[model samples]
Target: MEGFEIRLTSSKKGKGLFATKKYDQGDVILEEDPLVSCQFAWNAAYRYLACDYCMRQMHYPPETTSIMLLVRILAYIQQSSDPSAAIAKVKQFCHRTENEDAELVHKLLGEQFTHQMNTLREMTSHVVSGDEVQEFLTPEGFCTLMALVGTNGQGIGTSPLAMWVNSVLEITMSDDERQQLDLFIDKLYQYVEEESGSFLNTEGSGLFQLQSSCNHSCAPNAESTFPYGNHRVQLKALKPIMPGEEICISYLDECTLQRSRHSRQKELAQNYLFVCWCERCSSQASEPDCTSEEEMSDEDIDADD
Candidate 1:
């Protein structure tokens, strides 16, 4: 949290985060930890040992850590972290059942999907309350969890190794030195790929308190990034944000952002379960609605003739 004194304002979607002080472009607005987080299933399969309770990976610099902090530790951690707190802060997040992700629903309904879910419940039953675990086992509860994560999980992507490589390439170097360094890096990557085939962008997602409160806008003022190369998310202003302006983030990727409003709405509806009324969409409100921008272009050409 920086200059922005916050207001939890209400909207049809739920709540929105507003800034009480202005932020310059590239200024960091906030940094926060997640309530819970997990790496991509495929990423986890890459043999990165992480804490069972917190999801802190082991590949970083040497520090004492144990993956043995199981579901029991989850309950203990939550309880001990606050003790007197009645409701978990994560409960403030939107968890509408209708927002259950399509892919998540398909995966959960799969025959093999419930094996880990069932096993985890069985193993943690003694420590976690039966009622709590039982609710999560139900379809409605499952949907709620999926919806919460789907809607609020701010994506995190950072690689310290990749950053170091970029830093080395940026430094001034003689041609021969640069050539030798490039050759060494090529050989290093060859060895790495031999062991781990096709390493791609590290996709890490987390449920953040402040980030979850920020609403989506097709045109956004702020962005969430993992600059420190970990789960600690830093919200940076994409433009000069005014004192009273509400902070918004883009849910759609670059290609989707360029599409017709109708297409954008479809994407958001499918993924986020809401109609957008952001400024970008509002300006195009009077335009003839079509599925794709190309269709609109065709119609306009016909009209011009």
Candidate 2:
């Protein structure tokens, strides 16, 4: 909100962020904390642990993914006396299409919800007087949460000692006495990683009310970064911008910039449910014609984490 303002005009791309004043390259536009954040589930195959809240990488590996975070959010909503307000906020996000390739996204969301419910039931089955499950846990609510995450979640990167220590301790220590020793090793590793300057942790995903308003542009003028160690993220200017210019950011990886117009548009459409009409896309289209079937190199495809 420092250098930008939200414009909700119908002419614009739904809700979008716009510059309030001129900004030079590298100027910090806005620094904001997330409305909600969850640590990513660690994948044994990938051997990376990201923060549940900010998606920052930890010392060891991630054990729970976004689905775990979604379960946490749902539990919070169920415990609330009135969850209507929270549901209303989630409903604001755009939902994925049912026709998308193999219905993968839809299927995954459904599966994760079912898994969470079953896990909760098993955990509490032995309890004599467990709380009754909330009635609001429905397919509609699940889809709404998924849509909110798919559309608005921002990937943050940072190094936090507590996240690293807790993750490492959880895996290494089973008793209180051993936990103390594990903590020491955790602190030592953290210091080593920091001193080596080789740490690039993907802490977790977060939802931001202000940053989410910025739409995607292949040639974006603004870039989001997590400079602060906590959940705070900053949106910085990538180039000079005049007042009233739409402050855009790239939803895909930076490598997408090197891809052809056809490739970029296809990726955007499939993943984001939108076609690119930005200046870069337009300019590329006007250039030399290329086959739509041009194969993307293996390097162009980002490895799934």
In order, the Cα lDDT scores of the candidates are 0.64, 0.63
TM-score of each: 0.68, 0.66
Which lDDT tens digits does candidate 2 get at residues 7-64? 7735536778899899999999988877677655543334555444555545322324
Give the candidate number with the greatest TM-score.
1
What digit string (tens of lDDT, one per residue) describes model 1 on residues 264-300?
A: 8867876677899999999988876786568677568
Range of the 10 consecutive residues with the lowest summed lDDT in candidate 2: 127-136
Candidate 2 regions with alpha-carbon error over 4 angstroms: 9-12, 43-64, 76-82, 94-104, 107-136, 159-201, 287-305
| Ten contiguous residues minimizing lDDT sum, candidate 1 | 61-70
lDDT of 2 at 242: 88
- Backbone clashes in candidate 2 total 24
Per-residue error at 4 for model 1, in Å? 2.6
